[model samples]
Target: METALTLQRTRSLRWRWLWLTPPVLFAALIAGTAIGETSISMDTVLKVLANQLLGADYAVDRIDAGIIWNYRLSRAIVAASCGAGLALAGVVLQALLRNPLADPYLMGISAGASTGAVGVTVAGIGAGAFSLSAGAFAGAGLAFGLVVLLAQAAGGGSCNGRSAQASGAIILAGIAGSQLFNALTAFIIARSASAEQARSIMFWLLGNLSGVRWDDVVLAVPVSLAGLLVCLWHRRALDVFTFGADSAASMGIAVRPVRGILIACVALVTAVMVSMVGAIGFVGLVIPHAMRFIVGSRHTRLVPASALAGAVFLIGSDILSRILVPGQVLPIGVITSLIGAPTFALIMIRGMRAR
Candidate 1:
């Protein structure tokens, strides 16, 4: 009884803590604009942001409003959208696969994206008019379809037949898919028609947002919103599946159809993000796992917490990427793996000990 009371108190505290997320996210967004080669003041940044939002005639000095709105703001929005999408996809994948280590990349989505992105550059698929994102989406869609087919084949296309072995099989399939795609991507990268095009492919693979435009956000946001809605709508079903397929079935959750839809939703969102960010590795893995540790396995709280945590995590990473070098910026992807790898190792150590 005392243990139950302790759990309840902890739950209440987490609820209260979640209330701080929006303001925290807003503060981080504001701060993200403050740091750069120029280093604008917080007050100036806030005032400019406010003027734009409030349509006030007040002029802010020292900061380029055009630079802020056209350049920095789009980068920040892209970072946030990427974060939210990665975390949400992570949560859904973990639940569906019933494995803490499961992530969007685990299904070969990243590999497929890399393949498509590379293909466009090497083959000159669209020649002068081709978009990198189009290649990425095609690769991601192909990978998602393949993974679903492989998982279904392994499980007889039904949850009742999904075993612990299915998880391992799916993971192996993803590994194979990744290898095939990476090899193809590497081949294309090696034989690029022009050095400039090759350099673009290299930078895209490194996953930096040095050239983010408002158009990138325009493309990412709608797809992200649709994916976010799918995640939230299926939150309860995900939680039910956590108790195992038999238990979820007992609870009246339709497993196979739901799983298919969720996978497709996550893949679409992930594809959009990867296409924009060039495969921001480990956001999907780290953010959801961290939220699960703090908020427990319940999806009701897990989904939002993952989103908030991911936003904060990516925003922080982006700032580090900018400041890590005096005159040069590191790719945000490198920053995430640098931080995520150690954190994930620690989590695994503690989780193993607890077990």
Candidate 2:
């Protein structure tokens, strides 16, 4: 009876988090934009957002307006979008693969993107329309195609009395693809690259927000929304996956196609995101797992909660990266790793104890 009561209490708290998540996340977003060197107050952020959101044309100082609208706000939007996108992707993969440690990088997009970016930098490729982002996207697509071909060619697409996660074919294929692309990237970096180029590649891999702008903000917002919607739309299929393939098949769910669609969604979103901001890690890996404790394992609740929590987590991490030093913007990836690694350890311990 006591254990049951505790579970009920936990469930109630999780539902409360579901309601409170958006407000908290938006607050963090606003805080991230407002807390920079030339601090824009919360009131100013509200006014700016209100004017734009409501088309009210509220009066504000030109300097403050420029700072809020042009730079800080744009950066915050991009950060939040990337966070939410990556988190949603992570949720889908973990559910699809039934692996708690699964992340956006598991699909080989991160490695492919890094390779593309590195090649573009080192080889001076893409003199015309072949830009860095384009290269990254192309490379990610190539990696995705290869993984799909390999995984689906045999047992990855369909399950024959074995769980998808246990089959390990998709995971193995992804690892192979990642290794191949990473080796290509390393070779490019090792051969004839200057110190400046090497440093640029390193920063890109670690993820810097210095290049973020309204473009990323505009592109990422819709992509994030679309990806989240897709995931939520397919939540039932993901939940069915928890019961293993035979059960899911018995329930009339096409496990193979559903898995494909879910993974494709993750890959597409990750490619679009990482190509813009480099591979921002842990937002996806950590947010969903953390949220599961609060919201339980239902993707309906888990997806939305993870998205909001991810936005907050990344925005807060971005703020820390900005303020960690006087003038330097530290890599967002490093901050996430520092925060996520400890969080992962704690969760693992809790999970083991529960078991």
Candidate 3:
């Protein structure tokens, strides 16, 4: 009875905190918009948002309005969308693969996307026709396909039965695929890129958000929403996946089809985000783990918690990237790596202690 009561209390507390998530996410987005190199007041930010979003005319400085609407707001929205999408992808992969360290980029999607973008930019792969994003999407698909084939060849053909071995095989395949694509990207840079082109590719590979605009927001927002909906729809299946695939199959889950759909969803969402912002790491890997601690292990709570926390965390990270080194913008990936590396270490230490 005491254990049951304790569990009930925990659930109630998690739900209570969940209600606060959306407001906190909104505030974080607003703060991201307001605290750039040229600080715009929150009031001005609100007025600009109102003017642009709600068709309300408030007397805001034209330059501030333009910066808030065109630059910062769009960047924040895209950052949030990317964060949510990556986090959801992480949650899905970790759950389905039964691996604590699984992430959106585990399938070599980022490396593949990078290679494609570089091929287009440096090697002229598309003869000046395909956009970088198209190249990236294509490359990501190719890489994922290769990783899947490699995993299957290595006896991971099914994500059921001997799940641990299957998971390990897939992880190894992903690493190999990532390394191959990364090498291809480097080779293209070495052989074909001028200093200027190499510099641009390097910046983008570190995750650049300076180029994000309203057009990106259009693509990112819907993708994130769709990813979240799909994950949530499979929340129960994810919960059962904690016990491995055979257990999930015993529970009436169509483990193979479900796994395929979720993995494909993650691949598509992750590729789009990488194509748009380069490769931002750790958001996917860290955010889901962090949310599990806060909201408990239940996917019903964990899914949305991970999404909201990831969105807020990225917005905050983006804000820091802009202001951390005054007069110069750092790649958002650098900021995340700085934060994620230490946080991940601490999480590992705690996990060891708990065990």
TM-score of each: 0.91, 0.86, 0.93
lDDT tens digits by residue: candidate 2, 1-355: 9999998898889899899987897788789879876767788878888887788787888888878888888888888888898999888877766667667676677888777766675777676557766677677778767875777785566323256445477777778888888788878887858888778777877877777889788788998999999998988877877666677788998877877777667776787778777778778888888998889999889989888888888888889888888888899899999999899889889989999
Q: In model 3, which residue pairs have backbone atoms overlapping below 3 Å?
A: none
Q: In model 3, how large is the Cα lDDT of residue 301? A: 92
For each of the candidates, the C-alpha root-mean-square deviation to the true structure, in angstroms, is: 2.5, 3.3, 1.9
* Runs with alpha carbons beyond 4 Å of true place in candidate 2: 1-10, 50-61, 117-134, 144-161, 164-176, 189-197
lDDT tens string, model 3, 1-355?
9999999998898898899999999999889899999988889999888988899989999999999989998999999999999899889888877888778566587788888878887899989999877788788878878977898999885445356788888788888999999999999998999999889888988888999999999999998999999999999999998788888899999988998888778877887888889888899889988887789889999999999998998999999999999999999999989998899888888888989
User: Ten residues in a row with the worst lDDT in model 2?
Assistant: 158-167
Best by lDDT: 3
Off by over 4 Å in 3: 126-131, 153-161
Model-by-model lDDT, in order?
Answer: 0.79, 0.80, 0.87
lDDT of 1 at 275: 76
Model 2 scores a TM of 0.86
What digit string (tens of lDDT, one per residue) describes model 1 on residues 77-189? 78888898888988887787776767877668888987877677577767747587778778887876676577667663432325677766677667777777777887888
